[model samples]
Target chain A: MFSNDSQIGDFVKSAPKPKNEKERLAALKRLEILDTLPEQSYDDITKIASYVCQAPIALVSLIDGDRQWFKSRVGLDATETPRDIAFCAHAILEEELFYVPDSSKDERFADNPLVTGHPNVAFYAGAPLETAEGHRLGTLCVIDNKPRVFTDEQKDILTMLSRQVTQLLEYRVINENLKRETKIAKTMTRFFENSQDLMCVAGTDGFFKEVSPSFTEVLGYAVSELLGRPFLDFVHKDDIALTIKEVGKLAQGHRTVNFQNRYQTKDGRWLILSWTSSPSADGSTIYAIARDSTVEIQKQNELLKSYEEIKATRAELVRPKEEAIEASNAKSRFLANMSHELRTPMNAILGYSDLLIEEIDSSQPAVIEDVKKIKSAGDHLMRLINEILDLSKVEAGKMGVSRDTFKVAEVIGQVEGLVRSLIGKNQNKLAFDISKAPAAFNTDQEKYKQILINLISNSAKFTKSGNICVRVFEDNAAGVALMVTEISDSGIGIPTDKLESIFSEFSQVDESTTRLYGGTGLGLSICRKFADILGGKLSVKSELGKGSTFTLRLPSLAAKKSKSSSSQAPSKKGSKRAA
Target chain B: MKRVLVIEDNEINQDLIARRLVKKGYKVDFAIDGEKGLQLIESLQPDIVLLDMNLPVMDGWQVAEASKVNPKTKHIPIIALTAHAMAGDREKTLAAGCDEYQSKPIVFDELMKKIEKCLGSV
Candidate 1:
């Protein structure tokens, strides 16, 4: 045993126990300083502690559970010791300085390992290292192998040095946290700058507080130029009111998603943006992401414009066609009205002529002949009116075809009976060559008869003494059988140049033909139209002076009437019948 | 002799119809317009009435309606004669209560056949 001292008696005999040992240990663990490498800052504190106390050994120790780990040490080879033997562990339980000035003579350290082991015969002093929350983590302590005593001034200096050590630990913990937070912030900033979407933070005053690099790239403006400007200043004039309204919602702590607006870029072009924005928790700022939709909007506008243009062009094209149809319908109405007017007078002239002729004596040939001449002239005028009306109906596309199944021979017989007198009047012979004729045909019977009558009468007017041959046959061409009626005449033939024109409305072979024949020139044209209405064709083959043959070809099957004329019945009991 | 009433506005058409009927040994009475024709229907009490549509004051449809409604004249046959010989005119005139229909510039033979048929029916 060494010399006894009252200072060692004043020191607590064993380690002092704190009420919250677990919490104190947790505070020590939170420092993350146990068994760390000796940092210069901590080592500097321990060196100062040792010099001020005039001790041979010094340490910055963190007392962990069941162990004391040294963060920094001077004149000590060991970095750790058992907590039960550690002077620093006992120091952590006290609120003030702990001293064991003559470990061999002090009852607390009399049998301690450090008292009799290597670096023994120790004297010790420790200032408890406490955090800002008053949790004692460990100690900044000094020790000597020989007995020693500390004055009040040295104890105070050691207390101040221990406080400095506590400050360094707290600073290191805060600095480490700062470094980690800065790394995370740097990563987030990189993400914001590299994104293609326009990311922005705006103050409640509607000015941009911060903008990502994408904002500059998309708006063609520098980041400096766009910052501090009201976001509405860059919006399209027409869109400003709506943009203000949407921003007002954000200021009111409402989140807006996919709100669209047009923004004008620095280049004076409009960029369409779809925005999703949310207000900050304090409602002082808004965070937003925008997608540029200018190209998509332009494409939609182009498609709408083209559709409108197509609609307008269609209306423009349809007007003339409708007007033309109306005009043609008016002409047809006028012709029908005029025919009614003309037929009235013609009825009077022909009827009175017949009456007058009956009233006169048969002996006076001159007077009787004059009345007959009046009758003939009136009949001729009636024929002219009828032809004009027929042509009008055909031209107006209002001619109707009345289909009925009839005997071919019966139709031929009727045609022959009707034209027999005309052929006789022309001093011509009529021959019917119907060897290959079908027994029955399904077609428009009236149109068939009209075609035959027009052709035979045309031949009778031209031929005086020649034979007129009427041939009827079935032609199976193009996989469909057609009924072909050929009327050939050894008459004054049409010239090749005039043949095509002959089928045109009111067209005769020549003016001389009209004068000599005393016939309405609409005969062949009406016939052609009738054939067409029945889904047939009427064509003519002629030479200059030898002969002419008119062929009428009709489909063997009856065609359904066209919709335009299906409601109209072929006129019966009118001037058309007079023809 | 069967009696016939000719309702025609045009002077020539009236004269022509009258002469034709007189020549056929039928007694004929004349009215210049449909109003007069309606009056004459009671007075003449003809065997048949020839009503011409498109008259000056009262048209044929009115005259036909007026006469057909009268118990005294409704039994007498009325034939519609019209210069308005469009396709639908026949049905239109008949629908107005005419017993028969004829078109003008009248085919005298067909008219005579219709007149005889009307006269023979009653």
Candidate 2:
């Protein structure tokens, strides 16, 4: 069909194809200008190109698969010719103007059919129609029947016209796309006017080039107030910095997805808007859609505030226990300081008093006894201070227990030795009734001895020419083992009401008990604290001028080879023996 | 008479210990601070040392460690004196290589027993 339509029966049909012939031909066809009727836009470019170059023939030749089709022509009769003989085909391979001063001497086209045939071309100049993407689609070229050279000015003019042709192609394609989308455009126009979402077109100049009617509705602004003004003017003062940052990203060709910022409405309220936008191909405009997220943002803020409130409320419930722990720690530290400072003066006082009693002459018996009173009083003050320190340690939880397995009788024996001298001084007869005591007990040996020492010593101090008997009893109740020790003394007994008060810290049966008995009054309280450490209870039952029987009850452990004795002990908790 | 050195800071304590030691018929010398005490310990080379552990110039533990570390003075026995007889005081004195420790407001008789034992060992 091509042979019949063109005068090319004798034309050479084999010129070298471009390395990208497949892609180049495909792009050329997509322009849809090949073999079509000539239009005035392309024709005008060729006419100007030929007049500027002062050439006899000019054509806007687009290279197709096997032919060079003229989309527009000046002084050319045939519309197209075989691709193998077309000069524009080879011209497309060059980046800039492809000029042949003499086609007769050029090796590649020396014998081209058009060169020696109808057009009889000897000189040619073509400026490649390179698209913005660098695709050389075709060329706006001029030809002469005889050999000639194009001037520098004429060459530049051809190049400029070639670019004009490429732009005309771009406009044509855009017009076609717009025509194809007319039906969708009509529907979109209705949606853009009536829909609630804010649709807009923005420019890199920071102004809203166009806005849908919903923009005016949502922001309560007229189209006149919204369109020409800078979009940043409507953004909240706090959000302008971020708004400019997002605009910079769009200018860099980055699509904005879910970008949110606050905008001031015409009615003087802040509206939180969430936006998605894409930049136009030229990167000079932005196409965007936004949703009014004010309600959603309010809901999120409410949720966050409630969560913070819950956290604060929980902290309030836990504050007092922590404060109590801190207070106890402070008490322990103060007591430690007192313990270190108070003893230094006492050491000198007691030490010098002892020296006085020792060095005095034997003849001055009254002087010796007077110094003896000083020594005794010093001793009494020292004991009171020591007892107060010990009770303070117990209250602060600084007392530590180290548990071990030992014979109950063995610990009781140690206590007996410590209190025997006091017992003799008081003229009190002591008795032990440990007939039913266990062979071995698992507990802190020192704490157990301390508890026993306090109870025995208190009994000794309280009684004069009276009897103090300690009785031990073991019971297996409800599969739980308990060891109970009773120290019953026939002493100046406590009154019924005073029995419970005696166990409290710094309390005596009566004020006279402290004077006559000469006790610090912290003995029973310290013993009770020690008992508490050993997981035991201390209680007493007494009558005035009859006797007081103090009971020490403990969770008695059955001796065994155990890994952790403390963990094996049943979790024992009951009401404290409080008066 | 065996010469005894008493390292005590307080003048009353120094006088008390000195007079007591003199009464016991031992020639007694006194130094007021740990630096002077360490110096007297090296120069005098007394038969025994009575060191107050909580002295201002040098604590008893440092003096003990310093004296024990020196080959010349290491042979001299040291008896440490502390004010408050806290539970860990004895172990601390022993760790410092003190031969014996006595609590302050010293009972001159009990301190005498410790001193005799230390001197008897020498």
Candidate 3:
């Protein structure tokens, strides 16, 4: 009943035959299936039928043009068999239940390939599957290796279950189509809501028809405000013509790639925008998305402003330092000029005084007295000029610190000798107190001695009577302490309020003291500057009209003590002055 | 005899230094300002020029440069005299075409040594 073609051959042709040609054709169409895809609803039923009947083969079969095709199978895996030898085709034709019992014993079935090979119709059963329209589509059937018998109740239930199986397959096909629709809807909704850029659809007349939430969120406009409004109305006036040209191209179904321009916000600010537009098939709308670049534009402007400010401030700051240096250089030049004029006359005064001292007789009292006054005044002037020169050298950073080493005792002696003339002239009683001294120390001995001389001289100049004490001592605690102080009688002491200020350049207790004492007021300041350079300190403590004491502290070095040069220099001076 | 040109504005300083140079047997010439110094340099062709850096009508720097450039007077060596002991003044004065730099109140012995060196080298 299944075969008109011979590809499946005599293996299927010698089996069961359809009782009539009309029944054979009816059997073929009764399956009501051709080129149908397999479904699990029917396939599962066949699997269960094979297991329950304890057969090695089962099929849910539908007949095709030349063979019976399987919709589902448990053991037999072929999709089709030739029509002439199809056992299921014959079974499907019969209205009553069809069964083959023990094919090896029945003469008609013995030589059949269904008994000997593929189907081996030793046992078989088929119940037709009828669709809702009463079109029989296929069958649920089973097979067994040994003959199987079915009771009346079993046959009725098998046919009823087969009908139920057909209904479930049809339902599944309808459900698959529904699930496809739901998935497509879900995907489209996600694409619309989750996009980051502003997306919109506009009509051919240039009115916005649809816009994403990003449009309202980014531009601070609502859908009700934008809907049906001409899209160009929101564009910056300068960008309107360009946008119109791009939109015209968009209407021709030509996609605009990265078209960029500005659009004005409701707040009257222009926002930079870049977007691509695509024309829909109907040519009635444009689909586009844009990025807002206003924040980036504002940030770039702010950076440029700050850079300009920094450049301006940089020039403003550098100008003062240069000017200050130039002013200092100018001051040094003036000092150098004055020093030249002052020194020439000062040399003449000292030179003529030297000649006068030799020529004048000491026995002639008035002549000696007048010569003494000139020599003394000239000596004072020379000291003043020296001080001016020293201050200038220090300010210009030209003064060199001598590297020669000397004994602390030698420095103390030199300080005493240097101030002796000042002390004698000031009429101050002076004392020498030596607690201890390192035999020698390494330092710029010349500068060290000069520092001592200046401090002591200033002290002597201020003090008129009482006593001046020179004390030398060493401290392992830090370095060394040398105190050369004046305990004096006839002058007012430094005010406590002016103690720190006295170390400042050109500072004096009052304007009167500068006039009365006749000082450049640079002595103490130069001493302190020198002390600072020595990494030491010079300090004073005084009682008005009683006296003042000045102390100089220095650092000590322990190693390389065999500095014979320093020892020798101090010993010569120390012995000569010890008397 | 070596010739000396003293360019100075101050009569006292100029007389003091020039009298000492004349006593030492050098022929001395003088200019009161930078412009006169250049004029004197060309006409006198002195062996050594003592230039005061500060003067009216173009300072010593301008005088030294003009004197050093003129072919007729450029052979004369100049000693720059400055009253300022400022840093870099020496360098600047030398760079302006003075053969040496010395600060004043002029140490006669030191100034003489520098002058002799410039004259011997020239």
Candidate 4:
């Protein structure tokens, strides 16, 4: 009487339209289920049922107002089917079992669209699905792509499991309906009362519906104070436009995550906010959460400040090295050019001075005096050039030091001989207070002699017509002390304030003293450098209107020899060969 | 009078040294450069040569080498005059065939001593 192509109620033309149509409608309506997202609990049951029944497909079908919808399905990807054509609709018409052992051969199913095509109900069986109230809504069914048979025992098991599915559906309808109402109320309460973050529900029109206590704690405003106000009223004026734009996105079903902004507190202080928000139903109410981010923002600001400082210090540090290199290069270039210029002129002076001294008659006093003056000037000029070159070499870090064991007294005698003429000419009384210097100390005798001569000359030049004192003393522990004093009527004492910087290169007590004394300001600087090279320090103590005392303290030769290699023979040979 | 050749580029230095040698009872010949000095030594056959290390045209080292090569001039003593007192300069001059070397701002007494030593050696 029925073709496979006919739908569930199609057989109703011959059989009185299965008695519980009204009751089935009531059961489907009471379930109140349609168009819901898949739940894992229901989906897992369908998967277990298909595995147990050894069927490839299983579904929890709920008959809705106008459709048979799947809450969950194991093999099907669709959500709903038209109620008029649903097979589960016919399965629900049966009392105990509705089974089609060979759907392809069955007169009722052979020509059915679903049986002939996909889902191809070639073998089928179903148990009537019912609620606890005895309302049959759908079926729990197994389907096969080919013809199959089911024993009576398999039919009993299918009916029992389908009855369990119906009970679960009834229980879920009652329980979830209560849960939905209660969850909505609790979510609304949590949106205001118990959140750690300052949360709020605001309308799309910018009015606040609710706010959490954390809002009052963080912003110093009560819920009542903010409830009726436009949300923009609490927003910092500078942040209002941005806040409006972000709020607009939330109303369009888009959620804003970590959208930071600022708000004005009741006391007019700005509070920084890191906020996230989403739109509720009707797209009118905005659910938002906010954290006070001012501390993090301050830290960010401090980090940026430190970064800028580091950049400045990096530039500052790099500039000096470049400048030092440039200055050294400039000095080197100047020295090379100056050596050529000055040497050429010095050649003439030395050569002519030598010749003039020899040519001048011993009998003629004026000619001898003229030769003497020329020789003196030439000697002075040569000394100046030598000093300049030596200082340059020291500055360039190329000055060579030769250590040798020579008698201190012997060096003193050499200096005396060299300056014998100057001493006699100056008529300055010379006094020597030698401790007889501890049995002739061994040192770099040449450098010691050079230092002595410089010191003596300075003393003699600065002082006039007074006793010049030279003293040599020794300590068993500390090395040696050579002191020179030139007492004079001039009374040009170095001031106390400028004494500390006096030993520095190119520094003098004052410009007036420099002008009067006529010095290159390199003597004391050279002395200090030499003392430092010898592992000693040179210092000065002075008082205004009183003579300054300069002290040079150096390690003795014994210490130096212990520290360095005992290679005096080669060094002496080198120095003598150089001279 | 013993003959002496003074090789130097500076006019003032040449005039002064020549006049001095003349007064000192020597017949002095002047050469403005090392090449001229070599030519003068070849022609005049002076007893001694006072050579300046820094000279125009040909320097003292080349003149020394040339003088040592010539058998006749090789008999004559040469004293090197240098203003650069750098290390190894004395050995450099001596290695160039100078009999003696002296640093300049030349104290006449020192130069006289070296010159006499060179003369006595030759």
Per-model i-RMS in Å?
Answer: 4.2, 4.1, 6.4, 3.8
In the range A240-346, model 4's lDDT, one tens digit per residue, is 89989998888888898999888988888987899988899668989888999988998998999999999999999999999998899679667745865786687
Per-residue error at A549 for model 4, in Å?
8.4
Query: Which pairs clash in model 2?
Result: none
RMSD of each: 10.5, 13.0, 14.9, 15.6
Better of 1 and 3 by DockQ: 1
List residue ranges in candidate 4 displaced over 4 A: A1-299, A306-340, A346-382, A407-410, A428-445, A458-475, A479-531, A536-579, B1-81, B86-101, B119-122
lDDT of 1 by residue, A169-228 (tens): 899889989999999999989989898999998887878989999998999998888885
Q: lDDT per residue, candidate 3, A1-579, as tens digits?
A: 233234333433343443454553464453444557876777777777766666778787765556777878888867777766666666666666667777566554555666677656688778876555454445777777678776676677667767776766556555766788889978866776777788888887989988888778777788888895788888988898998888888888889887878887777778888888889997788988888867776787899989989998997898899898888767766675676567767766654555566556777878767877887787677667666666766676666543445666667676776678777877877776665656676555655666667666666777776566766666665343332322223346787888788888778888988887766687788787666655567888777776667766755323323565677889899999996
The top-ranked prediction according to DockQ is 4
TM value for model 2: 0.59
Give candidate 3's error at residue A318 in angstroms: 11
lDDT tens digits, residue span B21-109, model 3 = 88689998889998988899998888988999989998999999988888887888999998654435776898898899887667677
The TM-score obtained for chain B of candidate 1 when compared with the true chain B = 0.96
Clashing pairs in 1: none
Q: Tell me the lDDT of model 2 at A463.
A: 86
Which structure is stronger by lDDT: 1 or 4?
1
Q: Give the Å error, residue A300, model 2.
A: 2.0
Q: Order of candidates by DockQ, top first?
A: 4, 1, 2, 3
Candidate lDDT scores, in order, read 0.85, 0.83, 0.72, 0.73
Model 4 alpha-carbon miss at residue A32, Å = 22
The residue ranges of model 2 lying beyond 4 angstroms of the native Cα positions read A1-180, A313-324, A358-377, A387-421, A424-427, A432-452, A461-465, A469-579, B1-4, B18-27, B34-49, B56-58, B62-79, B91-100, B104-122
